[model samples]
Target: MSHTDPDRYVTRLFRDDYPILQGLVASGRLRRAAVSLPGWDKATVFEPLVPVSAHGDHHLRLGYADLGAQIYALPSAPYAAVLRASGDYRQPAGIAGLQVCFGAPDLDAATFRAELRASLAQPLKLDSTPHLATADHGGCHATWWPNRTLILESGGDWFLALAFNLETRVIRSPGKSVFGIDLNADPALCIADSAGVARMIGPRHALLDGLRREHLDRPLAPKEVRVVRALGYASGRGPLEVALRDMLSRAEAVGVEKLDTRQLYARFVERSREQAALDWHVSWLPQALYRARIRLHRVDPAFSTQACHRHPSHLGIVRGRMFDCPLCTELQHRDKNAARNIQARTLAVHRHPR
Candidate 1:
């Protein structure tokens, strides 16, 4: 079983289908509740289907088990005929600007291209445009056997191709290697290796740190305590801290603002420049710990709030409290979770039999 071999294990593929799912629900073929698989007791599954047009009607599909089988078994002649009749199925004269992943070993580039052309030549109202020229410019990487391919959509767009290599017993990569993370206003930090050191820093921290130093000569206000808290400080509370506490209390009276002390501390920095700096430090601290090679795993935010770590038997118990793990559990912020998941994925790639 080589790392790149696809026959070693069961395979699953997830696709970006929110747009398509919305279309399907609009067309009245599926209900909003049917979007995800329901049997998992351990994790939440969100499978949104993408919209594709065929036979003069818009349809929703995902690049997974059943859908893959349907595409593979689709008769070439009829499929082409349907596409041609649709009038919207014209393939650009050049490369198709699309990314595709194939799960079957029998399928190759030529067959895949043929199938796609057939599908596109139909009189379907495609939700997306066919910009075929962008396809050839992108590179392709694949693992043989069960045969999984991820095609990068070229032309400098945000488009991406992702597929599961079913032959390997590995989970999806959590962070950027699988999906891109956009850090605009939110403070984000990244660590690249097992040593658990900071590799990339966001601008929020630098800005706050500079402000704190500049205000060194001025008397610290009570509000400044919240700012210092953002930096992971434990000194006495400042005026900003008291004001925030009061505001939170008022919000709670109105039936809003349910969060834990740690979360509150984590978000304090977002309140002010001083606080924002602190927020960066608190968020980055976990990454630093991971980079230092500490054997720790971050909590999956998806399950953290909804499920209890100590009582796995109790599922969907959302108590509106900050989720805390047992002493045996690892504490990780967002970036750390991503970094660790990527590392785990890379290790799985190397460990699979070649």
Candidate 2:
């Protein structure tokens, strides 16, 4: 058993349109109560569904005999209509959801707490945060295979595998892969290594920007403006996902641990001060990295133009966006070089540990 799992896995089940077994939690009879499977006659129990992996790409397997049959018979369905996905916020732009058209049972609040005093080795920590997106509540039915443990939940049109597990460990990359990135600089995103080798990340904002111009350009009435705003809201998250996926693929290939970039927080602050209305140039890369278990670091991004890798001591002349030193031979793009220096600064800061 992995450390992420408990001695005996216990999955939480919430009853739909019913009191949450309040008597059990209040009576001090049980530390936590296992919910009753609706339409269950208290004979055969809900099938025990357990989560195998913790952080990245989790999967559910039934703790039963007919695993093959269960996998072949999961209630999955497709969307009824096709939307352009150009400007939809309620629906996922790139992510897909599992939907159950018909095969789930209604849940009930009726439950009996197990006298699990012997099951305790340590005090159990319960997370109170309610499931925001999909809850195993409401009138949406769920399927519980033989033996109560996990439930196949239905939320209106969406189907979800609602498994109860002891704990899950976050997946992480092995070690540090130090790289520098300059956002909104010459090549948009430039990742450079310690060997002075550099690579540019594609899937630039050009396509999205073109769509914004074509669909969201100004000089229009209320409806067009709404359409454009919706489009931006819908498609805005895609570029960051692309960049993050690209970064992850590269980082994994080279075992990247720390990604150093300019502190976008400060940039956003400065931009907000400059503009009357607030405009946020937020990147979901950091959040994505966090989810992917990658480390993120930042450095003062002002020195890229003033210095080059070849000679950190000598300041170079900035020509528009490029930087060059007359005394030294080669020339470097300001942002490109800055990208390298950013990584250097981060590594130096980390090594010194002031």
Candidate 3:
């Protein structure tokens, strides 16, 4: 059942599973439909019928086996059918053609061949396991069943996107303390703990630094731009992820300002040129917090920057990055105050969810 070579493994998989698939189709449990190939008009593939929500099982399922690796065998039929329709389903030439169509021009043929071969040997698994219980990353955590597997052809390249059915669960109650986080455009994240301690993580602007170093002299191509952006996002996000996880380990819940993009976009346009990196933080921070297994509250961000944490009703005077509360006669960083307000809002919502 396990073969080292991807081509041989896939070829044997098709040969071994064809009869079982045909039997399922004959029994009306699976249906056959035409899977269009590039030049073929009549290629057929089999797929299981969509079932009701209450159904206990599916024709295709995902399971972990042999050394904790995930496995399944559903997409092979359609994949094989595409190759068969092209007259080279199980042939070495077919795989070569796939490389030509999908592989990068500068990609080493042998390396791409190895990658494809290894990829085919491993198939996507479908299951309804709760994502929160196993939130170490990898796998889609949407609240739906029998997740989809996608084989996309974009920009003359083939891509695989497998969606695993991850069950969404209610966030556990915050136990020890709550941390309020304020993510600002200034490449800094301010955290305020319920115990009245406040701190800031970065003004590093990791994404800006990465991009500047990458595109120092020449303008990059579209593909190069994408690669740069992705790399930048990854580098910038690493520290933030570590910080969030560390905070969650100590706190029962973390509250964040529910930033409205329109407001953020306006602020970015007026005050900064680091707008591109903002997109990554705005979209990813909430999801990351949720997946960290702590109660994540998106508190209203309204007036957080303006209102003084020490005296809520007294609005603060903003002087550059510092805030001066008229009543307290002391100056504090704006982000620290915002973090405190976010923490207070989270506590309010947590106490009265109604």
Candidate 4:
């Protein structure tokens, strides 16, 4: 058996507990729990039919055989309808969930639906059975195939999070390409691969700025403003995902600048304070990197833009969009240069592991 860092591999199973389970937790009978799934590589959390509160609900956990099946299941019928009904659904102005429809564009609906129904049958059986795994303290059981083990703890109420513990060793990438990314306040992502190819995902600040302007004069609720920015991020994600997928098709790892929010906000003020609000919309970039299964390295951002990638001692003049390096033959896009520098630094760190 491959050993896992218990802390890292521990996936949360439920969010809020049912009243009976909550009572058990309150009475000190149960506090925390752990489960062991020997061969499963993926899992899913479904919102229960009823919720404890608007915010807190008991969610169910089920193991998936693979990612394709999981994606096929997520956008099916009721779930798809709910996603479409969301204010942010399919909106370019929302968060990263704008992809209302999951799976391939031309996925065979009839075949996928049939397969989804068959796959769900076993787990859905638990709805009526409601089996408990019988830990040292009481714990809910998950209906998964192959093998299962459940353990318990005596801590206070857990966070309302459903985590899926994936064994890191299970998902192995054959590619050896490394990529470095630079995220700009323009709400754009510039990627530089080891092969020297560089591409920009989006200069999405305009849409966010437009959103701010549209809502700036209104006396709307914070949710309304947030929804607009979320749509922007969601829309931005389409290009970002496309870029990442293309990069990862030949890459096993990715490197990104370790951003300092204080410096970012300060830079915003230097540019124009009016556009600073764009920061919130683009903040999803870091979260998006983590969502991928590939190896990730965060390189230091100090001097990433100012120093010349060709000659470390020579500083580069960073104008609005271009970098003029004294040692370089021609002008380079500031973000792309920064991305290349980030890639080089990441490679250095990996080669000489300190």
Best by TM-score: 4
Runs in model 2 lying further than 4 Å from the true structure: 1-176, 185-187, 201-218, 229-239, 249-283
Give per-residue CA lDDT, model 4, range 29-54, as digits (tens): 43333333322223221222222111
TM-score: the better of candidates 1 and 3: 3
Please list the residue runs of candidate 1 whose C-alpha ends up more than 4 Å from where it truly belongs after superposition: 1-28, 31-187, 192-196, 201-296, 299-354
Query: Each prediction's TM-score against the native?
Result: 0.20, 0.40, 0.48, 0.49
Question: Tens-digit lDDT track for model 2 on 1-354?
Answer: 122221111212223311322332244322322445332224222233232111111112222111211111111100000011112212211122111100012311111001111112233223212111122211112222222233333332111223221111223345545566655422445566555666654323343344334434433343323222322222332333344444554443221223221244344222211110111112233423443455566566556657876677778898886789766777777766776777677567655656
Q: What is the lDDT of residue 41 in candidate 4?
A: 21
Candidate that would win on lDDT: 3
Candidate 4: C-alpha RMSD to true structure equals: 13.9
Model 3, which residues run further than 4 Å from truth?
1-175, 206-217, 221-223, 262-293
> What C-alpha lDDT do the candidate models reach, one value each?
0.28, 0.34, 0.46, 0.42
Order of the predicted models by TM-score, top scorer first: 4, 3, 2, 1
The Cα error of candidate 1 at residue 27, in Å, is 5.0
